[model samples]
Target: MTLWPGLAADAAAQACPAGWPQWDAFARRHVQADGRVVDFSVPEQQSTSESQSYGMFFALAANDRARFAAIWRWSRDNLGAGSDKLPAWQWGRREGGSFGVIDPNAASDADLWFAYALLEAARLWQMPDYLKAGMALLGQVKAQEVRVMGDLGPMLLPGPVGFEAGRERWRLNPSYLPLPLLRRFAAVDPSGPWTAMVQGAARLATQSAPQGFAPDWVIYDAGKGFQPDSERSVLGSYDAIRVYLWAGVTNDGDPLVAAVRNALAPMTRAVVSYAAPPEKINTVTGAPEGRGPIGFSAALLPWLKATGAADALAAQEALVREKWQTWSRAAHPAGAAGDGEFNYYNSVLSLFGWGWLQGQYRFDAAGQVTPAWACAA
Candidate 1:
């Protein structure tokens, strides 16, 4: 599917600076001579395949064909290897120009994320090799994994760490990670295992916050609903909202849309009222829980855009604009040069929000898109 032309143009414009050459230079700097991303500026202080996957997709969005090709090559040479065949490592620091895995434990979500990223990249770049790699990764997960509590269905955690075997309850991120898996599965086999997984995740998410807003973290035992802990202002919630919005647009008649709509209400208010630099309030009425970087707000834009509620959308837009203005006035660098760890993720979100507001993507009168944001954009 072709991106909405207007949105594509807008995204391309927003991805770069006023001078195209400078933006191209920035893109080049992140990509190493070997084509892997080496920028410390990216979020999480790790060289995640997930981030590279996103970088590839966004590179396409920005119309950086060369960068896209480079990213594809890098991902293939590095991240495409399986666990048994050199198992992907998390980012780690090392001396003498070498890197190591931060933790031996493999995160299931990371693998799934890479798979989804590869699939999307394949579609965007029209490279069958990427698709083949994604399918192979999925096969690996299916061949060796078990049902994790919060994961909806059976999931494969990374190998050699053994964290996946002993855990009775799983941690909650629940938004970005699963959505891509579901989307990828749906694309390949509509009647496949992905639909069930997506529905299960939606159900689990709703159960976690029966009142609508989920906790920052939750524990889930297989066949049991979510066990809530303290709620925090998590960037994951916004990511979940984006996934829900995609589901809503894809299946408007689905009941989960309304459920998601209801859940996001309080989150919207919380960000608008109490969020501060590097932190978001946990409870709508309570003290600030902890520091949340820009990533928290980045997820908010897609949620607002999907909701299409004029008042809420306006509020979200204004809040983000205000935050950007604040950051700019404080002399923070634009596009992932902020003073925090999750800066790149947040920068992407903020840019996406700005692009949406500037009419990068097509939206209805209420500001909701008729299709998936990626598809529409």
Candidate 2:
């Protein structure tokens, strides 16, 4: 088992940092006072449910209840997030220059994360309101997001609509199903299809990566197995990076961990060969192209450590640490990192990757979060 810093009273003497400076920096750069996580990189300056969900999870992990409540409020007010409605996936400046929801469609992954964060927060903070909201939202997820495929049993679609390409063909994003969350849901909602989803998720992770490289999106035929998505081809890039992150941070004792890790072994080799993860790859041919962004390096940290690629992990750690100093740590006058306007996604990735390395938090076998303070207490 990984020994998290501050797990013991003497941990402070071991020179662990006082708090999560990275998360503090992220909040300043991306999160607004109104608790909206705006991506200033794009002209729309969009706020997606994914961003809000990530914000809530990070806040919970940092034990910042006030910020958590604020973020939840903004999402509830703007994104239509509540027990009765699945949060709208995207909000931004509209064509008329007025800010509003750009897309009414809900992203199932964000829905899961939102529910997970709320459920965990309720348990950790002993708040019944959070629990009530979480269970009700989870009910919506079960009703709308899950579908019974021909033989795949209960599989999670990417959203409530538009993903079912045909009567028998369905589009799936493998990265959306984090094993840890599935484990937690299985424990919390045993009567639901969470257990069956766990098994299906394992197949998605392993079978989708026939060449040991996960595709950004895959097509699942009712009778046939997984195939490269027609729209996305065989490419793996931004969306697939989270697959490694999810697999890496999953508790080692989970029965499906080894299979998922083995399926993603090619990523480790690519990182070693190029000295960093590739920005994109042809999942079918195992051909890589271009050096990935700093966020890609950050995304690989936990996976490298988990896979025992010590040298690769060191290199990525060094690169991330070096580049991290280039960005400002305070809220800028323009409400975005000037040159690092694209920092929102990278920062979230780092929070998950470097945060794990720094011992800020961890996931148990049942997918319960173990924040550093919780361990110390």
Candidate 3:
């Protein structure tokens, strides 16, 4: 999808500052030359619209305009398939044929990231095309993916299709709603449902976790309220971890900020009690499953700090730092796509959680990012 007209080749403008090299290293290791962020642990060497959207955000945060453009290009030409403004969620090697999008359904979280990153890139870098594209895609997301439940107000469906399990019910992913992004979207269009989504999102987090653990998926009963998705298992693991990370890093004073803190506060105790957050928790029962991996520690650092659990923050930071070394060793000569310890998802979480904690990026109340370089400037 080599459609971008061109970009200047100045290294200084194209790269993050020398001191902030982790993102650069991460791109080098995981992002392919074709602008695809490949998750190697998956046997198919799959790519997701979510990864592309995330890479765009990181590139914008690092001020790497070139990589951001390339990622956008690849996602549009490949996942978007040159037709849809919204890119398909998953792309990979098919069982019998060439590599391409396996499904055309747009994932709401990925679409949200794509729109948010594009608009923010426009603001941060003065790319008007990015802003225009972002607005267009945002409309598609709202038209095709967002819905108003019987009582839940406006809500983002997990995808454009297939989330409706049956009549009068829809499945929702809480982590899909980034509070800061919702605020930003509302800023873009005051009359948009984004603001209502902010309220609905807060309600989602607080109500879904009766026991203080967000579920990976919840069902809106139209009558009863948010309930656990038995198909996804009641356990909160990979998908739900990011909920805490996003909530913690959200700007203070957001309407949902207090709700996030209060709803997830038990995680602070979990970290202190176990020296690490549990790897899996039954969201309904609030029971521990196992000692969460190093990445879980990484994910909790910002949340721990946000909740004023200094000792817990310190413990997680220490564990996260130790795991960074493990990543280095696992990545040095052997490589980054390892088996158990430093996998693709773990690396991604570390980048977001640890990077936020270490001051690589911060989202303002309006969700405008003050990246590390911009901070110093």
Candidate 4:
């Protein structure tokens, strides 16, 4: 019942002849000349904190330090708005660079993610200015909108709309989004507001998922606590595991890691039993979602490596190999899938997986040194 067969053997080819070339083509197609990566080639002129963060990391992975630096600079200069301004909005128009959309305003989880991205960029580049900008944005988050959940502790709310009212909506996604920012902040400025917010969000998320499985979504009301609903997303849980792993390794006595470990056990079991080729079981339920291709399989590798579950990592590697082989055989010589706009976004995920498998990571499950290929040299 898996999506593709023989994928594992194909992924084990070690290196694909056209892999890097295909990846480079994908990056060139999506990344605009101005250094900003558009989100999914949408016509409305929108960019994303997640895309920017991944884009920067991939650029660094490819040894394009200048592009990485340029993206970070453009993000800060245009996305940050002004002095003492909050982090960038989730979505905005390229024309005037405003951040007032219903889906991507400043106060949403994406803003915090942008701050986290800057923190990572600063760490990689060792530039004090990026760290300063990250800290400034974190300070704004704490000063303007973080709230306390009775037992859950401090959490961030969505920021203001057009200089007036705040969104005040609490989301589950930010719980994972802010951890990297906190980890980086803790390394430099241990006593800063970002550190506190990180702890608060972890506590709240853990408490909310007492059953060890978080609901797909939740809405946080100012007066009331977290209200659970059925709008669940497998991607959200997958991202949450990454955040918890980061916290567990970076900070001492992290309960979030324990919760995630327990929650993911069933999903891992399902994959072991039934996952064929490129398919992954739903983290919440044991059912197969579909064939994950390269991107999703790649994203899961970090978590698998972080957990030190060798079997899981092996399974994922097999799936990735299948995807690469399939793409290689079917696609034309240019690496384009014949789709103009939807070029290689999915390939970014594959590159990330390949990079990690080749030992490009900040921390491992055992806290050993695993540097990127370029960094290792």
Candidate 5:
């Protein structure tokens, strides 16, 4: 058995510092006092359900009970529209600069994250309300987001509407399905189709890439299996980076872990050959397009260390240090790091990557999270 990196004792000594400082600063800067996680990089400075969902998860991981409660309250009040159900996907400045939920469609990815975060938070913090909200939101997702395909069983849709490209074809984002997250969900509701989606997504993450890198999105035909998405370009960059991140951080004991690791071998090879991970790759040919940012390095930390790719892990670690000087210790004007604006996605990637790098948290085979502080528990 390939034993993944665990929370080291010395590392645990610095566990509090090993996590959430960047996101904390990020929350202070971008998350308004109103609880909105505003992405200042965008012109409209919109806040999506994705931002809110991820914030909840990060807060739980950071063990920031106060921030988690605040974010949930704001999302419930504004995004919920008093419905007490799934929050709308879009909020903040719209086309005419009006602030509200411009679109009410619930994003399945965000919904899943919200539910997963809630369940995990409840366990970690022993909060009943979080568990209640988590189960409620999960039921909503199981009813609305879950769909039955011809052969794929219950697959998750990108959103409540759209993404259905044709009568026989549907678009899917490979990066959206993190194995650990899916596995965690399956554990919560074993009778549901979450396991099927887990298997399907695992197959897609590996099968779609000839060179072992995942695509941002792909078309899943009922009979043809996975193909390149027509609406999006054939390149994988921002959206696909998480595919690797998800695979990298998964607990080693998972049955799907070895398969995902083997399927994403091209990423390992690329990180070794180029001395760091490529920013993007051709979805079909596995050809390198450009260099990735420091966050890519952060995303790879777990998988590298997991697979015993010591040199690759060491190389990416060096690159992460070189790319983000404040990576080791939170240093920045919150999102305005050096000349570039704060990358919301990059920060997210770093949370998982750097969190593992510092031994802050790791998922077990059953998908329960083991934070550094909770090592005994």
Candidate 6:
């Protein structure tokens, strides 16, 4: 699991500039000294592969190699990541009071992020070992999670198992497929199915949103194409929020950027009209359920800025700024986890959307990572 040899101290010495206050606050409050990101809001006090992967990305974005290595280490040592087997999705206190892995199942989104972060870290930090590790993980992803449907060419599954309902039917999560990650994978491994995944991802985003709102999940049949997930129905909520975030951060030079924005234009209009992102929505009718949590506004920042929704972006920005103080207070009243409006998932989202809006990081059309330090240098 130790990918780098004898470079631990050197990595710490090479820590990137500390200029991002938002990231600083996050690392202090969310991530522990051992590099595990805990979701204290959950009763289980769980740590997931998603949390680890996102922490790696944020660390890399901040140019903090030591923290990145620490996060990777904890994930590999605890969750068995950085190996042939996909990382376990959840680790927390169990029923009997022992702390360990709760679910052995893998999450494809976290896997993709792990690979993406590793590969980019190699490029940015000039660590070829990371490139090798990333490539190996990418191979596992292709073998275990990717499948060529009956007529759909190659598509990504939600995980390595349990997603295929039948030979002609499959369950898919639209939010799991981020276009930038697909593009970056294709660039690294031209022969891989990552290219086809880009197109398939576009189809999912557009077709699943029949009414300009992405759903949390969808079903893809042999001939019927994409359909609203029967179990989850057409509800667009937490998972779907990342759809807009991904689309917004995609480089404008990418061919599919315009198409994705156009397909999800209603969200832009809705946010503009309401001056806040809806927490939940019916994808079929484009009907909003209610005003989303403050994090929803934070999540929509990049999309709003990219789409030229100045007034809406400003409104949400103000809301996030105002609410973040309350959230921080509620989350840390006694210097401990609070049972208030504070949410770990929302905090993660805010870090991502708000950090990007603040120019902490950006992705090229090829999905290359560009830390603000790189630009400044």
The best candidate in terms of lDDT? 2
Clashing pairs in 1: 7-360, 83-87, 106-158, 278-292, 279-292
Tell how far residue 40 is off in model 6, in angstroms.
0.6
Instruction: Give the alpha-carbon lDDT of every model.
Output: 0.49, 0.86, 0.80, 0.51, 0.75, 0.84
**lDDT of each residue in 251-339, candidate 6, tens digit only:** 77789888999999999999988878898999878889999887788989989988988888888988888887766554362225533
lDDT of 5 at 103: 86
Q: Which digits, one per residue and each the tens of the lDDT, describe model 1 over residues 44-151?
A: 445565556656545554556677667667655655444353235455354454665544444455556556656666776678887887778766655553354444
Q: How good is model 2 by TM-score?
A: 0.94
Off by over 4 Å in 2: 5-17, 329-334, 337-342
True-vs-predicted CA distance for residue 98, candidate 1, Å: 3.0
Give lDDT: candidate 3, residue 352. 83
Worst 10 residues of 6 by lDDT: 1-10
Using TM-score as the measure, the top candidate is: 2
Clashes (N, CA, C under 3 Å) per candidate: 5, 0, 0, 5, 2, 0
- Per-residue lDDT tens digits for candidate 5, residues 1-377, read 11224434442223433445666666776676667877766666678889888888777777777887887888888788225566898887887768888788888888888888889988888888888888888888877777777787778888768888787778878877877778888888888888898888888788777667788888888888778875787778888888878887787778887888888887888888888778878878878967788778888888788777988887887777665665434544533533252377676677778776665667877777776556544
- Model 3, which residues run further than 4 Å from truth? 1-18, 81-85, 329-340
| Candidate 6 Cα errors over 4 Å, as ranges | 1-18, 326-335, 338-342
Candidate 2, 234-317: lDDT as tens digits: 899999999999998888878999989998899999999999999899988889989888888888888997898989998999
For candidate 1, give the lDDT. Answer: 0.49
Each candidate structure's TM-score, on Cα atoms with residue i matched to residue i, is: 0.69, 0.94, 0.92, 0.68, 0.90, 0.92
**Runs of candidate 1 exceeding 4 Å displacement:** 1-29, 39-45, 79-89, 95-97, 145-168, 176-181, 190-192, 229-255, 275-292, 309-312, 315-342, 351-377
